[model samples]
Target: MIFFIYQIVTKPLTSKLIRNEACPVCNTQDSLELTLYMRYIAMLIPLFGMGRRTSVICTNCGNVLKNPDSSIFAKKKYSNKVADAVKDIRQNHKRTLWQLVYPWSIWFILPFLILILLGISAINKKNTEEKAKEYAELIMHPQTGDIYKSTWFENGLSQGVLVKLMRINGDTLYVVKTKQKIQMSFSKDEWNKLSADPAAFEAKEYKIKNFSILKETNFGDLFMYNNDENGKQYPIYLGAILNSKCEMDLGFETIERKK
Candidate 1:
């Protein structure tokens, strides 16, 4: 169980030393300094800003005067110099580049991630189209060492199955099914592992009519199914073949290996 952790971080943005200003607590001259702080919320990265706070401190006594006029400076007479200093601090207040950017980080971060996702989706779609074209070309050839990858939709879950062309005898094509059904949404490493080992494939070979069993769908993709009276397609049989590359580097000697 993991959760997103957020934190509130406070950082100093601007600081100004009030010259000739005396600390009311310690009576130390030229000790008062006013600082402006920016508060921001952060996750793994700094997300956005919360608010700001002002603080006044006495350097000699190491005392923090949060409110100058309402606290110790209440009894002291408000001088022209002190009032001008406050105005100067406000006028001179400026934030650094990071301080200005981190507060409104969400404005850019969301758009940046969205652009990345759209780029990835576009690449995947292009790859799928190219693979479909290769499959259409090789599906008609029906050569040995050719592996067909299909998605089996069952119980709202899709599982992947790999069928390999063992041999072709007369009008029948001998094919071997994979022992373990690969997940439709699987990693390349998982597919490579199953295809590498000979034991991962079924020992008994199945036979299907060379051209009769092979049929093209409306989308131009080829698949193996029975063309009986009701055009029955078995769930155990292979569905729409996704990949048509003769040699997928699955430790098989095919057209790619010869090239």
Candidate 2:
């Protein structure tokens, strides 16, 4: 398993010479520079209480000494100038008494935030690919040069019935009106009985104006189940009008290609 790693770093926050003082190592008066500095930590918060120390350096004999405490200044010869500088630094640069360490909880949450964004991106990509596949399956009727050879519900096919796709704009297909050619020609009274049904009509030309894509649509309630008694689901985009009121959904089945 791979894991992400984070690090905490330390850097110098302040470094400056306070004043000239006597070197303790070289025993030279007014020959050393008393310096006080702090090394701050860097992580998720502003932190500074780690190893704050002081260093004294001699100018005459090139000697240096270091200590964690500032009390080494008391061993030197009494100099009012160095003492005033030390007093000013102690008063102005004191660490906060409230917090010796900072809270680090936010650093643990960054990795989880990155994971949630990646999961949402993957789901959206899969949905886009599924939509593209559904569009490719629409049947294209040759005489009309439109519509796909969609799947039919079992026993849904009227014998010798031809479904001619006229035009496809969005999810709706404009089917051209046709006179029944497969069944015996209907009598005038029989024609009147079936005139309202799309299955009872027939078409001759591709350029006819009687083409209507929508049935008696109810704007408030536009989709109803088509006459599939077994509750079989088909692709709505394939012109499978299962219900009187209609909308579209993605298809799972695809047409098998010839090898």
Candidate 3:
């Protein structure tokens, strides 16, 4: 019984296996020894799965086995998945020619748009300045009063002189000295030129007087002509109008004095 048990223990397990050994279960010499490599391959089948290439099976007993060749398995699976993905991508791919062109087109177009906007703004600013200057020039000229409706002048020289003159009455003109420090000044002749023809004055040469502050309520006109004061009765053009101010000079010279 011990010898029988030893025979059974020493026997091979499968018939289709490569080695000629007796069967362990029945003690029959018809059994064959299973190859270690084949056993190893069989063990790896479930682990590797059906996706693998090198498969195995016992020819006589028909036992399913695994043969995991990592290189072949990986290559076949990777190739199949990659091929399927490539086919799907090809089917779904849309040709967007506009997408490639838009960014570069915007790079050129944006600058042109900016330049056009800047040009329009500059034109608007120029027109505003010209209108202001024209109004200022018109207000400066004593004769232009009939041409424009709302226009007035205040002191001797609005731009040139620091000392602002105010008309007290027909006989006297009051002088208001400015406390705020200013740099520019005008000569008597320069003041005369400005008073005579304000259009002739250059904007770059002189700054506009502070017209907002010097109104009729704060500082009256320096030279107001009554019926008897001047030979011809005309209102003084000494205050600030729309754009330009009265020609300011060093001396508080009235319109009568200027004449």
lDDT of each: 0.61, 0.41, 0.34
For each candidate, give its TM-score against the true structure. Answer: 0.53, 0.27, 0.22
Error of 2 at 33 (Å): 1.7
Q: Ten-residue segment with the worst summed lDDT in candidate 1?
A: 250-259
lDDT per residue for candidate 3 within 1-259, as digits (tens), equals: 3432111111111222333433333444433222211111123221111221222234445443323333443433212433343344334444244322432466777999999999998876776666545444433333211211112222443343333333333334333432232223334453333332334322322112222223333222333444555566554454322123333222333322132
Error at 57, model 2, angstroms = 2.4
Ordered from best to worst lDDT, the candidate numbers read: 1, 2, 3
User: Taking the tens digit of each residue's C-alpha lDDT, what string does model 2 give over 1-259?
Assistant: 9864444443333444544456656777767665555544554654534444555456678675544344644465435665566456655665654233434434666688778888887776676566444333332212243322222222444211224455555544345333432332223343233232455445542221211323223211112224366787322222232211213322322222222
What's the residue-level lDDT of 110 in candidate 1?
90
Kindly give the stretch of ten consecutive residues in candidate 2 with the minimal lDDT sum.
215-224
lDDT of candidate 1 over 116-176, digit per residue (tens): 9999988777766765555555665678876666554547776776667788887667777
- Model 3 residue 64 CA deviation in Å: 36
Q: Which rank order by TM-score, best down to worst?
A: 1, 2, 3
Please give the RMSD to the true structure for each candidate, in Å: 7.5, 17.4, 27.7
